[model samples]
Target: MTDQPLPGAYWRLWFAAAISNLGDGVFVIALSLLATRITDSPLSIGLIATFATIPWMLFALPVGVIIDRVDRRKVLVIADLSRGVLVGGLAVVAAFWDVQIWMLWLLAFGLGVGEVFFDNGAQTILPAIVPRDQLERANGYFSAAEVTTNTFLGMPLGGALIAFAVWLPFGVDAASFVVAALLAASLRGSFRPTNSVPSTGMIDDMRGGLRWLLGHRLLRTLALVVTVMNLAFATTQATFVLFAQQELHISDNAFGPLLAVIGAGSLLGGIIGGKVVGLFGRRASMLTAALTPVFTSTAIALWPVTWFVIAMITVQAFATTVGSILSVSLRQQIVPGQLFGRVNSIYRWFSTGAMPLGALLGGVLATAFGLRAPYFAAAALLLIASLLVATGLTNAALSAALTQYSPVTTEPTFATDVDTEDHDTDDTPVSIDRDPLDDLLAGP
Candidate 1:
């Protein structure tokens, strides 16, 4: 397919993501700093990160069901508004006096709840806004915007803002959410699933989503791999500040620029990610992406120098962005629209949800061993995950799965033999093909 510009609605959504992530990037740095200010312990920092991520494990299924049943635009609006008010309120509070760690933990949890809905809605609506062929490009646009705002502007600016006033970053974060909400409201057309069946009970709906994922061999294995990788990644998130401060001797004032460099790497990756995927092909691209963190983490662990670590992070960001563009585009193209939210949530429930555990592990490992220990541990875990992908995710396997996949259709059953109920709202009848790879990929 020839490359074409994405539709206006998609760009609107893209703009909204850019705005929101810009604030989110600032919020990440600000939050980490706030935690460090309140308590210098690694576990305290881990707790902050855990509160932000564990919501995915707790609410992914329900949020997915909600995204499927409602107009996705409304979901985005609500998420943005709620987050704006909540974080904005925190800013107001912090302006008066020193904020407490307990308060940060609570606010982080609340923001995470909003993210569960917002992120699911954001992913679910992409196929509706853009055609299947442009998915990689569309995703590339979104990733670029996200990394730029969340990392490039947000990270360094956050550090600077904190230096100006501790509460300033939070205020900026609140404003970004408000702007994002407005952008989301301008998007036209219905985003609800056209082929979704009536409620088969929340449990059944949730079960159906999980079963659909399990029925797809490649999808299932990928989700598991994402989970393990996320766990390793989170270790860095939870303790990177301490590592930079203690191990590398970077001062607080300069930390933001260093963090911002990570975003700079990701930004470059996002801009060229689709091209990389095209040149490398899916399997090779994905393998490279999977192994990237392994090598980067190892370099940081072994060398622990400032310049070397920065270079590795840039390479890691670039590789992961390419992989994400290819993988997310494939999933969006193949999964039925009605089931996309739920399936994507299930996908995230594994991939994103595992971060809390990793964060906790980072704290524990750092406490028991040393700050550098988490990097060593992360490298080890990532190496094993990469090896798994190299052995299991072959090109033939991906091609076979892609061959059997189609957009979600109104059918009596999904990828498995699970019974499906028809709704009067369905647009057309479609059935998902069950590949024999299910048995092999899903494991015994």
Candidate 2:
């Protein structure tokens, strides 16, 4: 069946996401550089990331319940507006004063809190805007926009602005957030999930979401694997700036461009992700995604050359993007829409929640051993993740999940005037072979 064009509301969401991500790209580079100015300690620098991500661990579950209860659009707008105000305040403070490390840590924590709400709301709202079959393609557009704007455009811009003044990038980031909030607010729709069960108290709602995810073997296993994968990635990421500066001898001016180069691969991955999944089945693509990081991390650790490290990171980003697209699309296809916010939150709680610990671990490892140590540790962790994907997330298992939840018709009802009726033209189910989860559950 020919694919229907994405709706206007989807485009608005896309623009909001792109603009905000652009700001994030700039904010990331600026924040890292600002933290470095305050303190050169690897542990101290890593703590910035730890502070930013700690909210995911503390607030994700309860926030998930809130997402299900509220209008996701309002949640997104409020989150963006709040971030804008907070960042704007930080920028004003940075312009006048010599910002301390503790101040940066506090700002990072505030931004992280906003992210916990904005990101989860955005994901939950997508299945409502776009059809089930078009999810991969729709997600591809979002991923591409995020990478292109955030890294390709915003990152280099951030580095340049930071060279001029530390406050500049933060100002730009704040403006972007405000603008994104405006665009998000313009999206005319009631984005509340229409089919959610009546709240049986917040704790019970949270538990129901948790139980649904845990009971599903594939999603459960995938969530655990991602938890470890995020840990490995964060471990390397926490001290990457130090590695670039101390080892590769990259100047702050050049650091953003180098990240932009690595982001080129992510851009490519987002552009072609849907096609790649179509070409290679989910199993092969996921396994490839799992294994690519192992080699890349090992190579970077061993070589430590500027060009070589960039090349390795670029390749890893491509594979990782494809894997991420597949995983999100799979979840949207199978999970009930009413439970999407909660389930997705639980999944992120397991995966993203590990980042703070990993960031701390990276700092400790880099401080005690060397900058190279985190890369080696990442390689080992990724190897284990690869094996888990190879053994547990087989093609048969993925197919079974899809078969059980075919023609994914349980989506949040949007009150928009734009006609989305054409998006789901093909509702025919594919033939199911067997219950793949049953075999896995009954394993020897």
Query: Cα deviation of 368 in candidate 1 (Å)?
Result: 1.1
Task: Report lDDT (Cα) of residue 249, candidate 2.
Answer: 93
Instruction: List ranges where model 1 is wrong by over 4 Å.
Output: 408-444
Residue 406 displacement in candidate 1 (angstroms): 2.3
Candidate 1 local lDDT, 162-252, one digit each (tens): 8889889999988887887776675445556556668968888989999999998888878877777778888876888888888889988
How many clashes in each structure? 3, 0
* lDDT scores in order: 0.73, 0.79
RMSD of each: 7.7, 7.0
Best by the TM-score measure: 2
Residue 302 lDDT, candidate 2, scale 0-100:
93
TM-score versus the correct structure, for each prediction? 0.89, 0.93
Write the residue-wise lDDT of candidate 2 on 281-315 in tens digits: 88898888889999999999999999999999999
Output the number of the lDDT-best candidate.
2
